[model samples]
Target: MTSHNRRKVRLITALAVGTSLLGLAACSSGLTAAPSDSSAMSSPKAGGNLRVGIVGGSAKDSLDAHSPVTHPDQARVIQLYDTLVSYDNDHKVQMALADKVTPSADATTWTVHLRAGLKFSDGKPITAEDVLFTFKRITDPASPMATATSLATLKRDEMTAPDAQTAVFTFSAPFATFPDIAAQYAAGIVPTGYDPKKPVSSGPFVLESFSPGQQSVFVKNPNYWRAGQPYLDKVTIIDFPDDTARVNALLGGQVDAIDQLPLGQVNVVKANPAIKVLESSTGSWLPFTMRVDQEPFNDPKVRQAFRLIVDRKQMVDQVLGGHGTVGNDMYAPLDACYPNNVPQRNQDIAKAKSLLAEAGKSNLSVDLVTSSAAAGLVESAQVFAEQAKAAGVTVNVKKVDPGEFYGDQYLKRTFSQDFWFTRDYLPQTSNSGFANSPYNETHWDDKAWSDLVAKAQATTDEAARCDLIKAAQEIEFDRGGYIIWGFPNSVDAHSASVNGLTPDKSGIPLTSYGFRNAWLAQ
Candidate 1:
């Protein structure tokens, strides 16, 4: 094996153990280790259209970034819209649409400068007014953007575009991680008068034709600000909700690449000499949430009991096929700002039963709702159910359709399974699934946790922010309702002829994988 591949395997092995040991030897664990950059693997040739297949998409998909979450929606949105900032393959934040991001002296205000001479695909001049509109739309109560809660601190009136190039954002409280929040996919910039029915975007590629579940086509934007980028003349994305069909399409050269490759099929993809497997660890995690506001789970003892019974190492090894690292009930596994001081929670059936007995529910029979909608949830749920039996807990697994899983079944179920994408910032992770946030699956709201997040958000000192986050994570480790057992490594398979596709551990296919930056070797 090459020295880089050997080093990567060693790091993954170390991460499996290091996460269980409270981040020991994990500072640089999987963060620095990455797959070989395909861009560097071959000379760039930009002409042919690339055909990409993806799992987890349906006919109901739309261009609306907030509603109808699907793989195709995610893959297609980046082609049409651009976030202010996005993480590179190495998980480092880089400018996309915004030229400069700066903070005020008190950290309560932020200023953003737009790149000059930028234009939407429709030839409309891109300006700071568009940035303000994007933010205001998400924060608007009637909007479907899930990121509204993240911007709750900043009032719409506090945002201003003094001129076409400059925009200012004033927050009710200090927000040191504003740039990270701006990097979210949901924060994609749209025109000041954006109409979902008729989309206007400023990304590398412009939407040519969209046919929901069947296919979508994008042509290179001639007016794109980044000169000579989007090497392909055209890009085509097909919806392949069926895993087998997606793999078959890639093997048959029906498509140039595929995303969201299931772990069970990794061997099958690798067996094809014409195909190459690219893997990277990103913000991807599969976790089960127990609603703290509901019965049986309302009792802290029951929550603790559940945490004590599941074996994280077994989940990583068996379900993920050792393609992932252990999780500590918290997200942002790759972000350097994540707290590492919390004591790692391990499985103990005896202690779990004792806690259940103390909670007066010695014979607990609960239902676990998981769906095939997200990869590995059903398998992980089955494994977790088997492991929980040792603690005298009877778990019933209910699997549902992947289509309805995200929108209908996931957060609605009391004890449910779901998958989370990578978020580079700690605050973005926290806001999406913690405290009183709308998507808080577990319904866990604690003053101490919320206070720490607020303080950490406001604190500019890196040391102080880390300390506060560590303390908050400790509280969640002891009492949070999330069972974050494993962080799955993302695997994308593509034809050998395809080049410049950067595999990212952050798991964001569009920005992190450098899809726009990728070129087809003609």
Candidate 2:
């Protein structure tokens, strides 16, 4: 994997929701106004009870931060742990538990200054040994909870924590975005000796008790580096497998906060006098990611034609209920790096047919595989089928169990000519759509395209990196390896009393809800 891909992968790929209910009328931007050096609401007053609920629970796959990919697990980490660095509301990196950070002259070498007298909730000191052990374990292939693949671009080097307050990292190359990478939950600092079943973290709250398929409880961490923080003495994170149940819990006042409110329920919540719905555009993309290694998809024209048939507006309007911003050609529209003038994919039946004919293809009948569990996903599949048919393509919609789809089936079928609809971030999805480079999930390997992605991921210069990412994005857009339908603003509902909610570029916008600066409306 190139540093370019790794740069994007530094972010999480999950839709985050909170499970607590407060009286919120409209869900505005959840941003923290703390100075660059501090979180605004950090008064260090740690005590009180906060009950939150999540729409769905996490599966067993990819829970390890090193190899982790699942949303629930990512959210879990963000909720219970703290990274060395974190992002402000504007996507800028900020200090979290660390007191200060100093990067080397080459940007490849860096050091973290941990706050003094810090300790995990378990009462163990947050020592440099813990930081060293955590990184070492994550880079190790055998660490049970390791999610190392996310850091594949980096050469394995030694991490040294000379003292409890200082952690140093030496990289193989100049990584300008290293600060951003530190904000990822996968990079969250764990207990010196992390135990999977018995977990401990140097964060605001302590995992008092955990249940595999049920509720997990968090208690305030008095030793939290930030003094007098974690206002809520106890936080109950209940897992409601269904969004409705989660919503119902919120409406009935069974929970204080709720995450993952269904897209269709936006109106219901807006109409409800007692409920509050917060909405914003997410950096996440719901696209028809095609594997380029397979037959038919190997031709960029063929892929472009298929994407042309998609009625993106309809997906955002009818299927999404007009609550989201349509992703214009690129995977995400709001990211700072998107190219504005790129040609968009309009629903052109005639053009699609012509392109298909140019490819000298068959009657164009293929299976559109997707998970039925994801909200609005089934409706999206049906709509795309109708749209593609207008351009002489027949889509056989198949509802595969998400578990199977994400497993070996996705990689094998994706690279071998099978088509599927999956949710992912635009930058990471770019790699998955083509198989040019080694990690290409679609196995669509093009040397030129690979080179662009490689440059985009590794180039230390900001302007240079942006240009390369844009070029790679254009290549994918022009050729049609990804049929990005839309980049809908995600809606996450929290009680009006709940404070300090912020959204990050990463889809999991549930961080920053510590409520230390958030009072229960005295």
The prediction achieving the highest lDDT against the true structure is 1
After superposition, which runs of candidate 2 have C-alpha atoms over 4 Å from their true positions? 1-49, 58-69, 141-150, 153-155, 332-334, 372-374, 400-410, 413-441, 496-499, 502-506, 511-522
Off by over 4 Å in 1: 1-38, 66-68, 434-436, 510-514
Q: What is the C-alpha RMSD of each candidate to the true structure, in Å?
A: 7.6, 7.7
Per-residue CA lDDT of model 2 for 1-522, tens digit only, reads 111112113253221111010101112311112344333444434355667776444344322334433334444565566777665454455567775666555556667787678788778888777877777776664542223433445555577778778878877765444554455555678876577566676777667776644676777777777655656677777766566788888888888777657887878877876666766555555666576657677777788788778788888997778866676556545445667778776788788888889998647887877663345666778888888777878888876654445445655554212211112223354435344221344455566767776555455555666677678778767765667677656567777656555544444455443434433432
lDDT of 1 by residue, 157-193 (tens): 7799999988899999876666666766656788987
Candidate 1 residue-pair clash tally: 4
Query: For model 2, what is the alpha-carbon lDDT of residue 365?
Result: 81
Superposed by TM-score, candidate 1 places the C-alpha of residue 177 at a distance from the truth, in angstroms, of 0.8
